[model samples]
Target chain A: MLNYIAVSTIPIMIFIIIIVGVKEKKDVYNLFIEGAIDGLKIVYKIFPYVLGITVAIGLLRNTNALNIILTPVIPLLNKLGVPMDIIPLMALRPLSGAASTSLVMDIFKNSGPDSISGKMASVIMGGTETTLYTITILFAAAKTKSLRGTLIAGLLADSVAIITAIILINIGII
Target chain B: MSKIWSCIILISIIIAFLTGNPNAVTSSVMSESKIAVENIITLTGMMCFWSGLFKIFENTSLLEKLSNKINKLVLRFFDKNELTKEAEKNMSLNITSNILGIGNAATVNGIKAIEAMAKVNKSDKPSNNMTKFVLINTASLQLIPTSMIALRTLYGSSNPTNILIPVWIVTIVALVVGLVSISILNKIIK
Candidate 1:
């Protein structure tokens, strides 16, 4: 997908060159280079943070810290009527999907794909995203550190999703 | 950072467990690298695919057309309609992405819109208008829920679209509650 985006931008660059020729009456080549350079500049600024987060995710997974966090949250989630198997997704939602997918696979294998627990977890997986990924990319793009209620709002949204899923499933609403 | 807090909690629990407090690691938490990987691929693919689709829509002018239509509603919420033509187009793309249940994509578009908005703003910090934009993005409107539907299909559900109604209800409720709180918060902070 990343490769596709990089490839797709080429035509857009060509269109700019055409516009420069037809309307701007300026140097088309220079405009193309400037455009590419601007993109490269943005990429350079963003790469380091992306690398750091990726590594942090890797370390957390390797150390089994994700499970460690999910442990306590599970019982409370279950008591709240959340499907126990879906707890890992909540923990994974702050990191990367690479980590979340692995948890999903585990839930599927253990609980069987048809089980309510497995199904609910899968549904939650589809409906939500990792909070960190959304925050990091959006905030970094805007060059802002202050979250300004985004985190709380995102968690609340996911909580609603989970609760709704459980309630509906238990009632056989879905 | 939440990460640091999580690490501390993990270490404390592990130490407690090693000291014969095995209850520290509840039976509920279990790590499976394989399951996590599958979820990552599927969800990320869905997000990227939707984001890419939105970009395509922008290139096709569908986004701009929609933006013009939504301009009235946006004007009411934002209290401004002074955006340049291009800015309106960008804002439309961002808003549409949120309405489509693609938060990741919406954020990408939101960043672009913010930059455009900031360029036009006279304020040092984010403007009231900018705050309203962020509030709307954070409280995003979702309809299809492509990711959730994809997950349902993946798990072998007989009717994946069955989730649509429930998703719509909760999303509407969320958007309403989120908007109200942000409006209240906006007044308090001001």
Candidate 2:
């Protein structure tokens, strides 16, 4: 898998290097280095937000808050044909991918990878997004404030992801 | 708000534990460390690859050309008379990051886009534009969901790529909904 991605990306990388170096009259190596640095800078800036959110989520799960949230929703989701076990994942879907991933890992560990619950949760996590967090941090970085219709729109989009994930899993698309 | 939810969840867990079914709460906490480490590795790798790709694209001037081409459509979304250097940079960054499926990376760029838009939208509460941009950033379409695929691999899934179709579908739908809402809301506000 690593080899496939690496090999495929090579042509792309070389193409970029040639175009930037010759056509654009830019230093491809320096741009590569700078980009990497910028990437690290981004990670550094967001690290605090990531840490706080992760720890808060951790504490919440530790105290059974997620279960409480999931308990009522599970029946409704299941009635809609969404897997009962995937409810927690669905709830976490709009938070952070890494955070939901940690949650999904736990689900996979307990339920095992082959279980329907695990499969469905994986699909949902992979399919949906953390709309609020994305909006918050992005806006904060640029120093903008009002949400307008964004919250509604983002949540609605997440619902689409959740519903699509359930439908796909049920139909055995994978 | 989180604290209130925490208290409620804690009470419920206690109730469930007393009732003799504790697996739900127990399992959720048990899987943290492994998940955390795995995600870090996957995200780091994915971000590295994407950023690398972005730099290469930028170096080639492809991103700039693309930015200019999309400027009209982009301007329509947020009517700013004069596009600044920072705004152009932010837009290119947003586009590149979104394409690579790293919305996290795009947030900063999105903010810059909003900042540039703010200069032009002087009368409006900056928060309004900020929020709208957040929606767009959150709904940003991802062509290659590297972090998600990595998570699947970490969890030992047989077919990580199976998620591609659904992700593509949801991403596009979300983008459409987000854009429509912003446009409608802008009209209402105006």
Candidate 3:
């Protein structure tokens, strides 16, 4: 039953959305096409950002620098029972969504999606936002020069989310 | 962004040369663009599909209805005089789309909300309500986390949705922490 709901969720959502569109007398097909085009435009806009982060990450990973950098922090993480594999994800997540997505894919590839590291990475990804990205864009829109405590609060929340993910996975609660 | 990008590349190149593997850096620089494009291609399909569906939702009264319901809850977060009705409406729409996990739509509404709030404020600095709203958005509590689930399925997870409950728990924890801290900071910072 749970699996059924899990798989059917999107389809059910689509159904309700369609019903709502129809009742509202919307040009649903045309609107969807327009929105899809907007989606394409969004992807296009983010492509350069994605490419930049991807190459940066690739260089970091391919050069073994990622390991070198993490060496110092690994012992502390190990003491907390945190898996070493997810360290990159934790570090990159708040900075860039594209970078972290790539890292999550890497985690899925290396550890398998059902593994503890993969589950924790998934939970962390799902739970948190790209804090820096969102803040930059929102503040730019608002034209606010002084962010005050927004950045700190957002990062703190991200930390809490990551810790919660680790604890939940470690306790076998998920 | 520029500083962080340069720092990462600079450090990576330095480490690569020191470790005597300049070839690895060169090859990664050459090949990663192709990998990035491939990842974008994979993401594009999902983005278009969900954005298309969300657009349909936007055309209907459903989004407005949902936003109206959320507005009641969101209003309590702000002082009654701090937000105009227009800002409150946009805030509700932003929060509604965010909770629904339609991120692109959420971003559009979020920008609108912030812009609305900006017009009402007298200073260049962010107002308390603006700070609170941005923090809530940055914490980004989603009920479904649709994109993550899709990525998990694409990776052939044996049980992709198993992480759903855990994500919800974590999201709530993050949001509560965000709200509490922002409130505390609002008092101390000013």
Candidate 4:
């Protein structure tokens, strides 16, 4: 069951890791500290990206700016049987995982978890990438020269996810 | 990057001013930054725990073992001899973690893989293989949708895993479409 796997995955991993560490005669605790510190540094590095996106999205949402920005596409999307409410989630999903994540929470809170729209939104979030964030941080870490193509392609894939999620919902598959 | 960042702030300010709710921007910025900080703070513990466990996995060469096991399969996605050995290693590990549904490790491997590729490629722009790598990560194929199911359960879905079949279907379709699109674009552009 999903619940069991989700609940126990970490503990199982930890158990296996401890055994492997002992078998290798390794100081697992210290190794973990080192990795933890690295994680700390990573969080520090990526925080700005996360914060900028959140602030931008929060402002748009609080000021009702997103509605105005998205209003033009609403009619067409509606005609396509796309759920009116999830369009923003689709647009933002590839942009910022944290922001779209909070949006998913909002949908679940308001729509109830069992609603088709809620389930569909959850599926989209799960299936797609936080494309911009991943590309930016990874390319920066890699020191790659090409940034534009990655972002564009990532966004294109995200659009595929968006359309696929909508169609599945329309077809009553989810 | 600077252009997009500045444009976002500028647009937010203009929207606030035109909407006659300038205070909303300030309040929202403050609250959202707080949320972001909180998000990081809470995730830090879990991140640390997993990172530590992964290190043990890495130190004992378990990662390398798994990486080697999948190396042949991973190579099929990439060109033979196009990537350096280091790049291939990272890519194999990345693909393995992705298939296992462990997103965190997948990302770490992805970045490392790109780093390896960058070292080998002398060009300034993204190399062909790097573009494929990005698309693959974007449409990652994993066995479990753990996070989504967890969220669904947290929100009271009786059958949180109901999307299991649909998620796989959509992800695979997205992956195939993305690969085809990128390959076409690559040919047209190059």
Where is model 2 chain A poorest over a 10-residue stretch in terms of lDDT? Answer: A47-56
Better of 1 and 3 by TM-score: 3
For every candidate, what share of the true interface contacts is present? Answer: 0.10, 0.41, 0.83, 0.59
How would you encode candidate 2's per-residue C-alpha lDDT over B102-174 as one tens digit per residue?
A: 4544665676776776676555454444555566667646665655565566667776655666666666776
Q: Sort all candidates by lDDT, best to worst.
A: 3, 4, 2, 1
Give the DockQ-based CAPRI class for model 4: acceptable
In candidate 4, position A67 carries an lDDT of: 71
**How large is the interface RMSD of candidate 4?**
4.4
- Clash pairs detected, candidate 3: none
Please name the candidate that would achieve the greatest TM-score relative to the true structure.
Answer: 3
**Positional deviation of residue A80's Cα in model 3 after best superposition, in angstroms:** 2.3
* Segments in model 3 whose C-alpha atoms lie over 4 Å from true places: A1-4
The 10-residue segment of model 4 chain A with minimum total lDDT is A2-11
**lDDT comparison, 1 vs 2, better candidate:** 2
The TM-scores, one per candidate, come to: 0.62, 0.70, 0.91, 0.74
For model 3, how does the per-residue alpha-carbon lDDT over B80-127 read when each residue is reduced to its tens digit?
Answer: 697887888889999998988777778998999999999999989999
Report the first chain's TM-score for all candidates: 0.53, 0.58, 0.83, 0.63
Candidate 4 chain B, run of 10 with poorest lDDT: B39-48
Q: Note the DockQ of each predicted structure.
A: 0.12, 0.36, 0.70, 0.48
